[model samples]
Target: MSVDKLDMQSPDLVYQNIEKLAESFPNCVTESDTGKAIDFDLLRQELSHAVVEGNKERYRLEWPGKKEAIVTANLPTTKTLRPLLKESVDFDNTENIYIEGDNLEVLKLLQESYLGKIKMIYIDPPYNTGKDFVYKDNFAKDTQEELFESGQKDEYNQRLIVNPETSGRYHSNWLNMMYPRLKLARNLLSANGIVVISIDEKEVHNLRKLCDEIYGEKNFAGEIIWKNSSKNDQDYISTQHEYLVCYVKDKSINKGNWIEKKEGLDEIYKAFDSFKKKHGEDWEAIHQEALAWYKQFSESNPIFSSKHYSWLDEKGVYFPDNISGPNHGQYVYDVIHPITKEVCKAPSSGWRYPESTLKQRIKEKLVHFGKDHSTVPNNKTYLKNTEFQSLTSIRYKDGRVASKNLAKLFGENLFTNPKDPDLLCELFKSFELKENDIILDFFSGSGTTAEAVMKLNFETDSICRFILVQLPEDLNETLRTASGGAKATITRSIQYLKKFNKPTTIAELGKQRIKLCSANYTKKNKPTIGFRVYRLDDSNMQNVHYKPQEYAQANLDLFSDNVKSDRTADDLLAQVMLAWGLPLSLKIERLEITGKEVFRVAQNSLYACFDKGLDETFAKEIAKDKPLRVVFRDNGFKDDTAKVNVKQLLKQLSPETEMKVI
Candidate 1:
C-alpha cells in the first residue's frame, strides 16, 4: 500500500474523476512514486473490454480568448455598492434593486451572497452589430488617459470597447465579454434555475455554443424565435426574427417546470366570456357560434389566431386529439360506445390504451365517441387541463412595440433598441414561477426586465423580485445639453430632469423610466411599487495605507477615524446591506433615541447609528428597542468610558443582540 495525494497544480477534473472511481474499486487503482495519478494500464485490466481510451482529440467550442475568459471568471472585485439615497424612490420599504455598475464586476460581487439563490436570469447583451458597445477587459493606456481627463470613466476604471465591423476577431470579442459573465451566472442559479438570453441571428449560433459549454449541452432548453416585426426595407432578405436561447443549470433536476405555463392572454378569455353569456351553458353550441364570428374576425387582428380552439365542453375550448397508438401493442383494445351497447371500431394502429384504461376513461367521460359503434373514438382533452399553452418555438409580435412602450413611459424616445416588456414578461412567465423568487438581469439596459417583472407581478399578483445591474455608461454630454436636434432622443426626459435639477447619466434614464412605469402601472393589490438604487464605488471605510518605515507616534492620530469624511449614515447602511446580503429595499425606520438618530432595518433586523454625538443614553434607548443586530461608528462614543460600557449594557438589556463597531 502507498499514500495518494492531490496535485497542487490548478484543478484537473480528469484526475478527480479517477479518484472517485478508485474509491468504489480500490483494487484497480495502483499508486506510483510520482503522485496519485491513475494507473490506467492496471485499471484497464479490471474493467477489461469496458475500458475507454481518452488519447483521441474530442470536439469542443474554442475561441481566441477562451482561456482568458476562464481566468476572468476566477478573479474577484474589491468594489462596494454605495446607496444613492435621493435616487431611491422608497428608500425604506422596497425589495426591488436597481444597480448602477459594470455587470461583470457586479456578478463577481454577488457570487457569494446570491449563489444558488436566483430563480431565473434574463439578459439581453449587446448583439455585436458593429456599432454596439462591447466591454473589453483590456485597460488600454490611451482610454485611461482620456478617462482621467474627462473624469467620467476614471472612477469606473474600465473601458467600454466596440468590436466594429473592421475588427478581424469580431466574434472572439463577443465571446470574451459573455463567457465569464455566463460562468459566474451559472453559479447564482438555484438547483432548478434557468437563464434566458436574447440575441439576433448575427451571434445566436455562437451564443448557443458558448452556453452549451458553460451550462452543459444536456441542459440546453429549446431556443425561441421571436418573430417580432417585419422589414419591408430589406436590401437583400428580411431578417426580422430574433432568438431567445434558454438553458437550465442542471436538466436532470430542473424538470422543465416552465414547459407548463404561458403569459395570460386576457383579451381572448374576455371575448370567451362574452360568448358564454350570449349563449347558455350549451358549451359546444356557443363555441361553434364564437368560431363562426372568429373566422370573420378581421385579418388585421393584432393577436395570434387564439380562436383556433376548435373543441369545446362544459370546462372550456380545446383542440381534439388522436387516440390511436402503434400496431397492436399494450395500448391496443376495443372501446364500448357511450350510448349503444356495442364495441366501437379501433384504428388499424390501435387504441392508445388498454381495455381497462379505455373503460376507466369512458367511466370518467374523457373518451369522446363518434355517431355509432362503427366509428372510431376520439380523445377529448379539455383546455383547462393545462391553462398555459406549450410554448411554440416561433413567436410573432412587433419589436417596435417596446420602443413605443418606452416612448409612452418617458414621454419621448429616450433609449435606442430597448426590449419589449411584453416579450420579457412572456419569457419570464414561461418559468411557471409561483411564490416569491428572485430574478437577476445583469445587462439591464433601459430597465426593460424590471418593468416586465413589475407588470407580470401586478397582473398575476405574484411577488417575483428582480435585481437589475446596469453599467453607468456616461451620457454623451452633448445630448444632455442639446436644446434642439433631430437625432436627440432624450431631449424631453432631460428637460424633465432639469426641472428637478438631477445629475444626468444613462442610469438616470433607467431609474426614471422605472419610477414612471411603477406609477402608471401600479396595481392596487400590490404592496410596493419602487426600487432601491445602489452605485458601484469605493468603500465608505477609508484605509490608512500603512507605511512600515514611518515610526512616528503622532501619525497614530491620523488613523483615529477610519470612516470616510463624505460618507453618511445611509451610505454605511447601504454597505451593511451588501455585506449582510439583505435587500437594500428592506424598510428602514429612523428614530431619535436619546438625541442620537438610530436607523432600524426591517423591524430590528439591525440597528445602526453613525452619529458623532453618541452617549451611554443612546445604547440604553436602542437596547430598549431590542434589535437583533447593533452597529456604531467607533468615534461616535463620547469617550472610551462609554465605548467599553455600551456593549456590556446592550448585553444585559438586549442580551441576544450582536454588537459591533466600524
Candidate 2:
C-alpha cells in the first residue's frame, strides 16, 4: 500500500460534528459539493413532529459577531507547538506542561490528544474592564482590514487589541473573544470535569449568560463569592467581592457533593497526635493540655475556632454535643449511668437519636455523661469524623496574601494581582483528583494554578499533573502605555527578566515564577515539580507540504523537502506526536538504528526517524521490535525503489505496524 501522509494540522471540528450527526440521524446527513454535511431542513424535521418553519424568534444570546464566533470555534488551525528544551526545567520526565501561545489556537491543537481528558479547568480571563486587552483572532479579521489595523495596535505582533469602552462594539468584542475559547475549552473537559472562571462585577452578568448557554443551564454549578478585598474606590457601593463561576461538563455524570478538609484541620490533627503521644490514654489530661494549647491562638484563627474539640478518647479528639431533640417532648427513654449504676437525668427535649442508637453509643463509649446522674448524657462528635465539610458558597481570603507571596518569591513585585495558590489548592482539593489527572489553566497568569497543583500533589502524595498556557504579552510595550504604580511595576518586572537574560513578556515571568517555586521547594520526595515548555508557532512543514498542487511543476525541483529549513528533527517529532493523537508528555528516546537516527516513543508504541537515506536494512532493523506505528520523512528515502522495498519489508516482518510519511 502507498504510505499515508500526515495531515499536520489541528483536527477539523466541523467534519467531526458531521460524523456525529450521521451516527445519530443517518437520514438527516447527506453528501454535498464541499463534503459530508448536515441537511438542515431534514435535521429540523427529525427533531419536530410538525412541519418546520424558518426564522423563529427564540430567547437566546445574540450579538453582531455571534455567527463569526461560531465559525472561529469550528475552524481548524495549522499552528503547531514547538518544544523548547532550553526553557524547560525537566524536558524528558515531567508530566506537567507549560505552553506559551494564543490559547485559542492551543486549545484547537489540543482537541484530539486531550479530548475528554482534562479533569479540571481554571481560568482568570480578562473581565472586560475596558482597559484590559483581548485577543484579536486572525480568522475573524479580513486581510485588508488586518493590514489597516496593524498600525493601530502595539508593536508586539498586533495579536492583542485593547477593548476600550469607546469602541462601538464593546460587549460584542469581549463576547466574541470569549465564546470561541470557551467552546474549544469545553471539548477538552472530561465527562465529569468542571471549569471554574474568575470574574469581577464588570462583566459577571454577561459571563453568566454566556456560560449558561455554553455549558447548559442545568449544568450551571453554584458560584463562589470570594470576599478578597475591601475596595472603597467604587462610588456607588464598595465592591469587595469577585466571583468564581463553576460549571460541570455533564451534571448527570458528576455525582456527589464537592467536599474538602476544613482549613487548619491538619494542624489540629497534628497537635492531637502529639497530645496522644505525650499523655497516652489519659483522656482528661490530654483534653486539659489541648485546651491550654488552643488558648494561645486568637479567636480569628481557624485552629482556635476548633477549641471546643479538645476532649480526647481512644477514637481521637472530640467535643460534647447536646443530644436533646428540637422540641421538649420526644423519644424519652431511661438511661443508667455506668459509674453511678443509677438512672441518669434525661434531657428536657429527649434524645436526638433513637433509644437503640443511644444504647449502642453508651455501650461503645461514644456517650459522655457528668460525674453524677444529675446531668443529661451528651453525644461525642469526634474531630476526626468531622474533618471534611461541604464547600461553602462564600469564602474570605485576603487578596494581598498572593501578591505578597509572589513578591517574596521573585524579590520584587513582578506581576499584578496574582491569584492565591492556597485558595486554588483548596478549590482543587474539593474535586478529589486522582493520580495523573490533568488540571488545565489556559489563561495562566502568574502561574498560581501550577504552584497550587504542585503543592497539592506534594502534600497529598498524589501525582496529578497541570497544563498551563499563557500568551507572551510584552511587558516593555505595556510599560510604555502604563501609568502611575502600574508603570513602576512593569519597569521592575523588565529589570527582573533582564537579570535572568529572559524575554520581556508575561509568559516569561510566569515561567520564572514556576522555576522559583521549584527551586524553593525543600521536599526531597518531589511530586512532578517541573514542567515542559512549548511555544505555539508555525508548523514545521513548508507551504508545499500542505498544498503541493498550488505550486507550479517547474518550481517543484527548487524545494529540497517538505519540512521547513530551520526546523529541527525534535520539532518534527513534536508535530508528529500531536498529529497522531499522542500526548506531548510521552517519554521520548533517541536511538541509532543501523546508522539512521530514530526516536522511540513510549517504548514500542511509536517510532520515528526524520534522517535521510532510509533503506530496507534500516526498516528491517526497526521492524524487529514491531512498533505499533512508524513515521519517516518523505524525501529521506534513498530512491523510490528503496522506499517501496522498506514498506514491503515492514509489512512482512511486522504485519500489524502502520507506516506513514510526513
Candidate 3:
C-alpha cells in the first residue's frame, strides 16, 4: 500500500468506531426511577439480607440463604522494632548493574523509593513474538475457582487463560499486560524526565497509544528512528528501522537543548594548513576552501565565525561587532587613527564605548584606517579575541563520526549498541550539575549512561552518582558466537573503561555485584533480610515429597527448566511486598468460616489475603472487618462461588476500599 493510504488506515480509529457502536446499543431491560438499569433487583433483595442489623449500611447483600456477613476488625497496633538490612545493591561506586529476574517485579519493587525520581528510563521489553515468553495474565480472584466448581457459571468464567492468536482478543491481551506496568512506570519518571521505549513496527502504534494514555498526550515527544539492522528478511520488504518513542513526564518542565559548543576560530586557522595541503594555497582558492571547511565545522562545533570578514584596514579576519553596548549615557565618539590622522568611523553602529572612550582607544593604539587616507577608518580586532563558541544543533561530519570511532575503539560489536558517551557528556556540560545530582537509568543495558556521566565528572571534576538497572537476559545466540555470551557483554562493557585509563578492574565489577532489591513492602512481619528470589511456577512435578533431597532427586525429570521448589509463591510475594515498603503489623489469618477457605489480613484496615480457595462464609467474615484493601490469587476462588457478589459484598460493607486480584 502507498504511504498516504497506510497513514489513513489506523487501527486506533477503527477501534474507536467499534466502541461507539457498542455504546449506542440500549439495555434490553426496563429503567429505574434513577434512570439506571433495573435488571438486578432480585440480586439486590438477596444482598439486603446479608446486612447485620445496625451495620446494614456497612454490608452488601448477595443472595437469599447465601447472604454474606459484614463485620469490623481493629487495625494492627504493632510497631517496627528493628532496622532493616540494606537490600539495595550499591552501584553508586560504579556504573554497571546486572539483575537476574522478571523486570515487572523489579519495577514494582522500585516504586516506593524511586517514584518520580528516575531521570531516564529505557526499556526493551519482549516484543510479544508468539515464541517470546509472554507474561501470563492473572486477573481472576482467589474466590473465582471455588464459585465456578460450586455449580456456579460466573466463577468458572474468571479462570486465568493464556492469550492465543485465534482468541480474537490478541491485542487486548497485550494491552492488559502492558497497561498497569506502563502506569507504574509513569509514576516513576521525574517531572523533567523522559522514557524511551524501543519497539518494532508490529506494536509501535499500540505502544504510542499506551504511552499517550499513561504519560498524557500533551507530554508526547517525537519518535526517533534507529537503524538496528542492515539486513532484513520479510515476506514483502526489508524492515530496518526500530522506533524509540520518547515521552516526557511534563514537557513544559523539561528544558533540554542539544549539547554542542562552537569550534574555536583558532581551529579554523589550524585547518587552513590542511586545506592548503589538500587544495593548493592559491590565495583566493585557499580562502574559499578554508571558508567552506570552517562553515561545516562551525555548524557542528558552534565556535567558528559566522561572518568571515577581515578588518577593513588590514586588521585581519575577525567576527564583526565584538564589543558590547555603551556603559554609560556618555556618547563615545570614534577615535582617529594615529597613523592615518582621520576620524575612524566604528563599524555601522559606533564604538562600543562613548566619545570619552576614544582617548583610551588612541592611547592603546587600538584604532586602524583604510589603505586610502580619505576612506572611512576601522578598528583593529585580532582573531585571538574569540571566547567560547555559542550552542547550536547543527552537527558536523567530524563530530557525527566521533561516536562510531569510540565504538570501534572497544572492539567490533563488543556491545550490541553503545551510545556516544560524548552525547551524554555534552548534555552534562549544559547543566549546572551539582555534586549530588543522582542520575538513574533502569535500562542500563551496556552501562553507557554511567560511562558518559563518569567521563563528564572526570573532565569537570564534579562528583555525580548514578543508578543503573539491567536485566541479565541470556545473550542472543548471534552475540554468543561472535563474542561469547553473557560474560562477553559484561567483559566488553568493563573493558571499555580502559579507554579512559581509570583504575577499573573486572574484580571491582564483580565486587560491586548488583543484587536484586525488592520494594520495601515485599516483606512480611519481619522483612526478608536477604534478596527475595523467585522463579516462574510450573506444574510438571512427577510427585510431591516433604523432604527437599527426595523431592529434588525424584522430581528432577518433572521440574521445568525455570521452576523452583525451594520457596512457595506466598513466600516470594511477601518478600516482594516487604521490599516495596509495605508496613509490618499487617494481620494475616486463614479462615474456613465461609463458602471457601479464605485468608484475611486486618491491621489499620482489613485485606483479604485469599490466594487459595475462598469459602463463602470466610469471605463473609472478611467482609465483617470492613477491609480497606483486598487482593486475591487468580486461581484460588472456586467455580460455584458467585464472583459478582464478592464485589457486591465489598461495596455494601466498605464502599471506599479498593479490591484487586493478581
Candidate 4:
C-alpha cells in the first residue's frame, strides 16, 4: 500500500532547467527539432549580459513533458478567433463571449491580448476517471495524430481518445494536457486575479501540487469543500462533495476583498419599514414586538431573521457589536447609560475610534448602552447594515437547482451535474468584483459560470464582463442521441453537424444555456442579455507557414499575395487583432475610405486595412489619426515609389502610429 521510492522515476532535470530559463526569457527561447528541444545558445545570446555561468539548484515542479509544455506556452500561434455574428446575440455591445475550440489553442490565442487582464477565473475541468479522454498535445503529432486532428469528417469520436486506468502514464497524460493551458492561463491573470478550479477527490491532491508549481506556493489560496449533491446510494460513504482549489496571482493585492451578506435583509427590511410607518408613534411597543419576534424566529423563515440583532429602539432591531476587539484601538470619554443616567464603564483596552468618531456616533445615535453605568457601551450594528462576511471554506448548496433548470430549458439531461449557479454567484460575489473587472472560465461546461456571472451582475446591478472558452468536445453517450434513440427535444444545428455524423459539442450546449438564461432569468426589465460568439480555427492566411527552409525570395514571392479563399477581410482583420495585443471584446467599426474597407478597433487602439493596391492617399488618410497599431496586406503597396512615399508621409503626419504589413 506504499509507494516504491526507488522504482519510481524522477522528473527530467534538463527540462526543468529549460522551463525555468524560458520563464524569464520567453522571447529568447526558441523551439528546436519541431518543439522537442530548447535552443539554449539562442537563449543565452538573448540574455548575453545577464547569462548565468552554470546551473543553479532550486526547488521546482518537474514532469516528463514539463519543458515541452513550457515551449508550447511560449510558442507563437498563428491561430485566430473568427467572429460568429450570425450565431451571436448583441454581437456589437454584449460583453460576454462564448468561444468554441480546443482550450490549449484558445489559450495561446488569448495570451497576447489578455496578458495580465483577467480579474477572476472559474474552471471545472475533466476529473480523469478511467473512461476520461484528454487533449492530445500535437507538438510532436504523428501521422495517426494528424489524422485524428483532421476531424475524420465522418467519425465523431476521433477527436477524443480515452486513457484507460491500465495505461502506464494515466495521470501523466492528464498533467500534460493541463500544464500548458494553465501556464498560458496564468499570463492572462491580473496582479489581483484569482482562479478557482472545481475538482473531485481523484485529482484534488495532484491539482494542488500542480497549482502550487504554476501559481507559486506563496499565492496558494484556500480550497472550498462544495457539497455537489445529496446522494444516499454508494458502496462506501456516498461521495457528495467536490473541491474547488483557488489561487491568486498575487497575495498582496487581496487587501480589501470582501462580500456583503444581504440574503435575509432585503425583504425583511421592506417589511420593517412598513411596520415602522404604522407604529412610528408607539416606538416602545413596536420595539418590544420586534424583540419578541426575534426570540421566536427560526431559520426556516429566511425572510425575517435578527441573528445579528440584539438591541431594539425607534431605529429598529440591531446588535451591540464591539467597535474593536477587547484590547485594541483608542479610548475616549465615558458614554452615559441612557437608563441608569450614570457614567458607563470603559473598555479594558480602549474605544474603537478617537474622540471625533465617538462624537460622530453620538450625533448619529449609533451607540448602544449596557444595563447599568458599570457596563461599557458597544457599537450598535443595525439590521439594515450590510454585514460583510468572510468567505467560508465549506459551502453547502443543492446542485440540483442548476440541473432542474437545465432540464426544463433543454428538455433532456444535456449536461449532467452542473454546479449550482447561485453557489457560483456567491463565490464570485465574495471577490467584491466590479464593472470593469472580467471573469473568465476556460472550462465553461454547460455555461454555468457564464450564467453565474450574469445572475450575479443582475443581482448586484454591475456590468462585469465574462469570457467563456469551451472546447467543441462532443457530449458523452448519456447526452447524445446518435445511437438511434429518441429525437433530442432540440434539433442539431451548426456546420459541425455536416462534419460530425452526430452533431453536438459541449460548447454548443453551453451557448444554448447562456441564451436561455439571458432571456428566461428575468420576466421583465430584461437586462442586456446576450453574448458574442467566436470559434477557434486555423489561421486565415494561406498554407505558407513560417519555417527556416521556406524563408526564400522565390517562396515568399509565390505565396506573398495569396490568402485562403474561404477567408474574408474581416477574418484577416481579426488575425491582425490577435497579432496586436488588443482585447477581442473591444468595440470595432468598419469604414470605407477611398473605396477600401478599413476596420477600426476601440476607436484608436488599432486599425486594419486589408485592401490591395494601396497608394499614398490611403496611407496618409489612415495616418491622419495616429492609431496605436495599423496593419495592411503586404502586397497592398502599388509600387516601391508609392510605398516609400506612404511611409515618409505617415512619419510626417502620424509618427506615433506603428505600421506593419501581414
Give the number of the best model, judged by lDDT.
2
Pairs with backbone N, CA or C atoms under 3 Å apart (clashes), candidate 4 = none
Residue pairs in candidate 1 whose N, alpha carbon or C atoms collide under 3 angstroms: 92-587
Order the candidates by TM-score, highest first — what do you get? Answer: 2, 1, 4, 3
RMSD to native for every prediction? 12.9, 12.4, 19.5, 10.7
lDDT of each: 0.74, 0.83, 0.47, 0.72
Instruction: State the lDDT of candidate 1 residue by residue for 145-247, as single tens digits.
Output: 7555444463555457656765646777888899999999999999999899999988999999898899988999899888887777777888888899999
TM-score of each: 0.74, 0.82, 0.43, 0.73
Off by over 4 Å in 1: 1-76, 138-158, 232-237, 260-379, 389-392, 477-504, 525-528, 543-559, 621-628, 648-657
Q: Weakest 10 consecutive residues, lDDT, candidate 4?
A: 547-556
Candidate 4 residues lying further than 4 Å off, grouped into runs, are 1-68, 146-159, 163-168, 267-313, 319-381, 409-413, 476-503, 520-527, 546-559, 639-641
lDDT of 4 by residue, 440-533 (tens): 9998878888888888877887778899988776553323323322224223333333344434666777877787788655546565587889
lDDT of 4: 0.72
Task: Say which prediction, candidate 1 or candidate 4, comes out ahead on TM-score.
Answer: 1
Candidate 3 deviation (Cα RMSD):
19.5
Superposed by TM-score, candidate 4 places the C-alpha of residue 602 at a distance from the truth, in angstroms, of 2.0
**TM-score of structure candidate 3:** 0.43
Model 3 residue 417 CA deviation in Å: 4.4
Residue pair clashes in candidate 2: none
